[model samples]
Target chain A: MDDKLPGTLPGSRRPGRGPRQAQEIYRATLELLGGGGYDALTVEAVAARSGVNKTTIYRWWPDKDALLGAAIVQSSLLRFDVPDTGTLRGDLSGLVHRLVGLMTGEATSGVVVAALAAVAGRPSLAWLAREFVTDRLAGERAVFDRAVERGELSGSVDPALVLDLLAGAVWSRVMLRQAPVPDDFADEVVKVVLEGCAVRA
Target chain B: MDDKLPGTLPGSRRPGRGPRQAQEIYRATLELLGGGGYDALTVEAVAARSGVNKTTIYRWWPDKDALLGAAIVQSSLLRFDVPDTGTLRGDLSGLVHRLVGLMTGEATSGVVVAALAAVAGRPSLAWLAREFVTDRLAGERAVFDRAVERGELSGSVDPALVLDLLAGAVWSRVMLRQAPVPDDFADEVVKVVLEGCAVRA
Candidate 1:
């Protein structure tokens, strides 16, 4: 999804920075976002906080939304690294566990709630929310793809529905209900969804 | 949820009114909410718009949150009349169809989006959002209870998870993605979830 950002300046144009610089910039972005929200976030503020040149930030990210999008993609909030646990159930369980941690984590969850609040408050940033969810969905699709290849799931199963069910249950429990998720939540969701899809397949 | 409102006045203590008057009040509340959001909603405006006495409105609902909560429950946006289709699949499908309509309908969807925006913007009113979801979940639980009684589903199945998945997927599609749900979405979700739970049971 970061690849879809508007400006992808050439590597040569970058000021010969290391990954440490990029991490600093993203951290500053999230910190500013968490503190004052989207309206408070600006390329100039991020540059000042991270000591990165504003011109360099603009050279890579075209606008504030692009910068925030990139920062969110780099954040723990949107990381959807597919797990290859050899079985569909195991892979899903691993993914759900990571999601639970992200939602429950102190620093990460605050950033997430802030971002969502920003999007909810501003209609213009609705695209960012959509893009964020779409990107994560795309990343999570790999698990189902691998499951299909391994013959654990038939191609007939709807990956979107499966992923939505899994993540939705967690969102409902964590965000909506504002209740403690049981220790076995990830395993239970994975078990039911995998069994449901397997039977349908 | 409306019953859980802070103050519920007795029938004998109020002014005489018919269902039409209550409907007018709810309609006015929704209109104000849909127009200017939560900040614009007030007991005074609702009374003016509905032509009901402010004292009477206050007698029934103590404050703005209570009024808004009651209006929401009375609106089609939160109705969760469980279907008795004789089978869990049929009942769930019916419920999902109604949910999809509420999310997709031109008028109802706007009210839903407005109410959600209000809740998201104001942290204090988060209880309203939580109560709204909890109420709907409680109402929808009847389907599972009936299915259990008929032996179609084991009591082991998680009703909360099931409802979350169904509503969550629709929300993801209609609100998050701003995408049109496929015609068969309800049926597809019901089929997979029921088959999945059946296998687990």
Candidate 2:
């Protein structure tokens, strides 16, 4: 299917000539944003780097913000596919591992973190946040909900909230720049939270 | 005592000397950050606004990064004090509310967000991040550890991991700018994770 196409990989490949052009512009876009922040991700520079005209990029993405957003999508910045390991602990651990890996990876994490950071204040990224996270959360939720249906979770627990809490911690860690994202963090998180660890009266 | 001082209530305070000057500089630091992100925030501007000298700020702090770090010290900028609520639900909710209030507040939130965005490549902010979060986490860890000691949490539960997972979700939500930090999020997080939605084996 067209869905399982190139350019969607972690390294970013191009599809149509237009898609390829977009990818090239996006490459320059990432370099600029990565080298600096949102401010330096200029259309002029991106065009120059891609060897394409500014008019061309503008026609595709409209503005610096749009170009950045498009570049993010085309660049394969976020991979939300939930890892399946069957057990709740395994599932959640897999989820956490995937996230921590994505966040801590050297090549892409910078731009990814920056995307969620200062420039995210721009109105343009707001919709992108919703679209990206919603879909991402939905994917994870399906995994959790399946666990619930299998009676791994209390039937009453909210899947979305569960994912929210899990993702929230990593986001906080990264946002605060507090400490390294531990590899076993996801495993321990699933173990403690899923199994229970509070004083019951 | 120098610690027992007036003009400490933020906006209404008058700038006098010593800590007051620091406060004024911090206040200006926040304002400049709001108007612009990390790049636009200059020590010179902070000095000018606070009616203090750049050398003075440098005397207290090594550089602008340190100055900015000082500005974000354990004051209202970041609330690390978490209470010992007996129940996990109450404890987490209390902590989450405190954090949400701090990170989502009008004045400090912007700086918090911007600082996070800029921290990625700076590397200088690493010390700031550790000093800021470690103490806060220590407080919460004590609370959770108490619960564990009292048989509130299972003996096997790792307090650090729980805290990380809990904080992660809240961080992601805030950084992603996806939704308002709901008051009940922490409570729900505690319940779903601790109680387990799956049918008990």
Candidate 3:
């Protein structure tokens, strides 16, 4: 997820600060989102709960959707970094596993889906969603780029498409609830996607 | 996609009926949706605009969501049936092309995304979205099954996974808008997926 918080205060938190105020604001946002899906969440509630002024929130986020987007990125997706296990399979599988872990969690899933709904038609929020996904994919793209460098993958391979295929499959399972994401599903997908499933024994 | 409307009244239109009233209802629903999105659409408004009694709409559809869901399915997804080409390549590409057509259209894309947002947190609407996807995949699954029977695919291949890969790729392009669904993107995806990207020439 994109780490650049909109209108972030750089180096503003002095050494005497007891705790980063942004952390408190994020916690309040997540709590409100969990308690009342997306509709009931408001900047006023966030301010009341976080003890931060509403103007500060607006100055940083510009809107509720932006605040929620930043909070979600900070809370959930920021945890995973790109994996480099020396093989495409290892790296891909690791990425999928990390995603599976997040999707399977109740709190994260609630926040994620609610956030998507909150941003559905609004152009700015939609752009934020696209940016978040793109930023998260950057890590996986690194793995693919490395594979290309090592000649494990063709230099012409579209890292974006590769990431889309892998991520989309998981999204279908988790968001659409068509099927469960089994422990081995990622490995199977990586194998088929990498090696082609058409030529079977 | 799913031809089965949840509570469709078949042959309910009598001989004296000049034009089907359901069409009017659906048109009004779409108009309201296009103007104000899912939040502004109401059965009462549909009734007022279409001149259909609110009681009648309620009789046919249990609630506003059911009405909107039915209207969306009727207006959009119902029109596209699955393609049956002689080969998996043809079938997959055809399916992707059909989806690209819908996603690229302004009206359909608006309705589709609005419907998803309307159903995001609600269990019943979520179920409807899941059902819609599952029903759509059934057609693609048929193509895969036929390929296996024709010895074009391995008998051990997972039909669900194949559908997931294809549909997921399209969903990524359309829903995530990460990349454009180039005219040849489907063909490229089919080739890579079928032949395996791992072993490049």
Q: Write the per-residue lDDT of candidate 2 for residues A64-177, one digit (tens) a residue.
A: 766665566546555556777777778887887777777778877777766766344554566666656665665677776777777776666766666766676665565455
lDDT, candidate 3, A17-82, per-residue tens: 323577788888987876777778899999999999998877667677767766765654335877
DockQ (C-alpha based) per candidate is 0.36, 0.49, 0.51
- Candidates arranged by lDDT, highest first: 1, 3, 2
Clashing pairs in 3: A194-B198, A195-B196, A196-B196
Q: State residue A97's C-alpha deviation in candidate 3, in Å.
A: 2.0
Which segments of model 1 are wrong by more than 4 Å? A1-22, A39-62, A120-123, A197-201, B1-22, B40-48, B51-62, B120-123, B197-201
**Model 2 residue B53 distance off true place after TM-score fit, in angstroms:** 3.8
How does the DockQ of candidate 3 come out? 0.51
Provide the lDDT at B195 for model 1: 68
Docking quality category of candidate 1 according to DockQ thresholds = acceptable
Cα error, candidate 1, residue B70 (Å):
2.7
Local distance difference test scores for all models: 0.71, 0.66, 0.70
Off by over 4 Å in 2: A1-20, A51-53, A120-124, A154-156, A199-201, B1-20, B154-156
Cα lDDT of model 1 by residue, B12-122, tens digit = 132344244667888899988877767788889999999999987877667878778767755654575778888788888898898888867887776777776666545
